[model samples]
Target: MMTMHPQTPDILPRVAFVATGGTIAGTMTEDSKTSWAYSSAQRSGESLVMGIPGLLRRAQWHFEQPYSIGSQNLELGHMLQLRAVLLRLLESPEIDSIIVTHGTDTMEDMLYFLHLTVPSHALGKPVLFTGSMLPSDHEQADGPGNISGAFEFLIQCLSTNADVSGHSAMPFGLCMQGLFTPAHRVEKQSTAGLDAFDGPYSVLANTQWLLSRNALEMSEDSGVQGQFASLFDPTATRHPLFEAMEVPVVFCTPGNGPLRQLTDLLNRKPASVVVAAPGHGNIPEACVPVLRRLLLNGVSVVRASRVIAGGVEQGGEFDALDAFRQAPVQGGNAVFSEAGGLNLSKCVMYERLRVLAHSLSV
Candidate 1:
């Protein structure tokens, strides 16, 4: 059930805490030192909020638990449902921002999905994602600290209207270890470490601890927002890709066997096929012929890199291929951004193609 926190003085900003249950809400084992072996979704959003010391006083807050499952079980349907809720919340005049507690495993993918599907016009408000590496009941549980830190970050942004890029609006972000990282740049690096997430390609919003020994430290203005508006039109009538009947992602390797494997994936008639190519989005020379055939047949084959940084550049083997030489291949460059680090562009491209395919069918 959803519940609203009492509004504070009119001067304070109102925030909505939407808990989608992750390790942050997980129960601790008897030993207390180990958090891996526990029941997820064991706690509610209200309970988690109350656990944060002095958090209720920081802002006017509301709580909702739309779904309480480990991120490993998250499906496309869940993302679609979340998007609907977010759209509704963003429309409210009372809510100033949103904080989502998610499981770490699929957090980045969810952020990417939301980054593409959420309407740009409604993105004026901030949406922050945070979760804990340890369970709530653990002695040094990081969930309360993370939530409090994120709350502080959001409160400060309430008066900020400037976008970091100065061109597009940045409506979404994540806070880890008190560092305000844009959503597209954040990547989970450790499974159990308290400070597990980091921004790969961008500078830290604030390197110093925001909340040390319960003392609050506000983040400095980075003058940057995740420029999501450039990815798609705010007025576009595209449906959520997760709602699509099928969206398969096929991985491509550099072996001679990749040609046959790639052919088999194309025969399935997927909405899109993303090749996890080697460095710089290079497909195996042997596999180029098969990719060309599929492209000729109107299949959307995106060339994505398996490496972590520096996105696929244009004019490579892909450019020399028959399909790309004649016309541009549906590569992963469209999703690349300075703030979008590595895997984000590829993830967004996969779902973007899926959404385009669904729009055509409808």
Candidate 2:
């Protein structure tokens, strides 16, 4: 049997806390309005440890970046920078774990991105992502508790070398909401509840590593890693010289003018368009003509719902099939192009286009 070494001074785990401003570092005013307002009076990431005395006493702490921003402001570039930083830290022989203090609003999206970007071989150290729904300045803030929990979790993860293989096998990506995987699979159980991430799968019991090294090795050998990397590198400049493909996203609102404006935008940019239907991917009949014009101009129009819970249904009440056929008929396009479902889909499509472009160039 392999003997596990006890954590002591000789084997003390070093932890890096990367704080990229979120509610975790946000300030609340005396009026009780939660805001992303930063105050010089507020404690910094380094001060967080002092704020919660005795927390993380055994571990060495390092803060990557201080000053919090709302998660809504997080972008792809930020994700890239964070990944590069994490990779750099992972290369360090002393660092044993990493904790990211993020805002809960878009934490899952960021976590999934990190999940895809961080290499498994370089991921031996524990990487715990945590945040609180309440601001740190709130009188009844959960930030302190959550941060404490995250630190404890990281220590435990490093001590045990928990198995993360399951995470690696996920076909889509991991979405951690209050400690639940595929966070979309779980719904927020309570409005201000501590166990907001409660799901049917009993997530609290399954603290094992989401993905294993062996699985990553197999996937890497199969070239999946390379393919995924190529798909995600949006800065790739090479492209095939072919008929332009434009995708348009039309946001349907109470007024018909928004759709018309979108159509006008689509006309200006000669590419396929994906209409972000207001409800169940439904567009107003008044806006149908705008879509029709784009189709007439050879632009492919796809339907995507703005609703976050459910996806766009095919051959549904919206006459989606006919509309698609009337258009140039490219596949579905995402309404938003950020690091969510839409971005993930776009990444896959872009990868295919890149491969085709490379083939054509050859």
Candidate 3:
């Protein structure tokens, strides 16, 4: 007879893996080295999760595959679908946390869309998103490591009591960039870095978990579903209300054309115009006239800073205060301006104008 060793206790928290296919699920065919293909060989999300070295053994795991499409092929409708699924999960009490395996290509856009649509409170839970730069089938692929890192991050968040419960009034917390971050501030910093995302504000504290509070409160009475249905109609009209809507985007340089170029773009009768101005959303004295002209022409003119890492602060020389105090209010809506700087501002304006057009139609 032999003495038996004592069993070690399990300490990992239960995790739910939501696999939205990307390069992580892609494989390379031996014959065609030039082509990348997806294989059903490792099709199931659960099987993929179990294939990871220690994830399944460490935690009680669950899996759901909403779709197996590549990330590059993702569309706005797909994002809405993903949001619907996530909303359902957030409403459920059985799941402890969520991990979304996604492609890196459009991850930033997806993150921003989620941040804007989901309420701060629903964000209180530990929802981690991770993906690999390399395909899973490659010998030196980063997929396994990234997945392992995500699982480890979830374990750390739960074990440290950082994923707090019942804190439903605050924004949901997200762990990305091989660390934790808020969805709004999550952005990609490098094309091929393992730790690609950067959250400058440090919105996520290791001890804090996001609480889902004040989500856009879905209702049967609301016509949002009907509106969404209309979007799918092949005959639905898609048009921007203000024609030739264009924004002049320029980075900070000593002598980049301040306002002349912006005013010129506005002269084309763009419904709205955005200026990727210098630091703190400031424009040179020369550019103010261009802004004024656009406003006079009933063209919406917005100012966003050139800074990539921080928000444009108010109370600067080129701030909207002066425009607000002036009569006729030619300046456009500053609300359309975004903190992520020019590119994001463009996207925000595009979406805003799209909404405005829709409202006009109905």
- lDDT tens readout by residue for model 2, 251-296: 6679866666765765484444556667667767777776665555
The deviation in Å at residue 342 for candidate 2 is 6.8
Candidate 3, residue 196: lDDT = 68
| Candidate 3 lDDT by residue in tens digits, 96-163 | 66788887777766665565555445554567777666667777677777677666666555555542
Lowest summed lDDT across 10 adjacent residues in model 2 is found at: 218-227
Candidate number that wins on TM-score, 1 or 2: 1
Mind giving the per-residue lDDT tens digits that candidate 1 earns over 201-277? 32333323222212221122111222233433433334454355344444565455667767886677655556667
Candidate 3 has its poorest 10 consecutive residues by lDDT at: 217-226
Candidate order by TM-score, decreasing, is 1, 2, 3
> How well does each candidate superpose onto the true structure, as a TM-score?
0.75, 0.66, 0.63
Best by lDDT: 1
How many clashing pairs does model 3 include?
A: 12
Question: Which runs of model 2 end up more than 4 angstroms from their true locations?
Answer: 1-6, 33-42, 119-122, 164-202, 205-228, 231-249, 267-274, 284-289, 292-302, 318-362
lDDT of 1 at 103: 88
Q: Find the candidate with the highest TM-score and give its number.
A: 1
User: Of the candidates numbered 1 and 2, which has the greater lDDT value?
Assistant: 1
lDDT of 1 at 153: 66
Q: Which stretches of candidate 3 lie over 4 Å from their true place?
A: 1-14, 28-44, 57-60, 68-74, 159-163, 168-177, 198-272, 278-290, 296-299, 315-321, 324-362
User: What local lDDT score does residue 195 receive in model 1, on the 0 to 100 scale?
Assistant: 66
The alpha-carbon lDDT assigned to residue 197 of candidate 3 equals 60
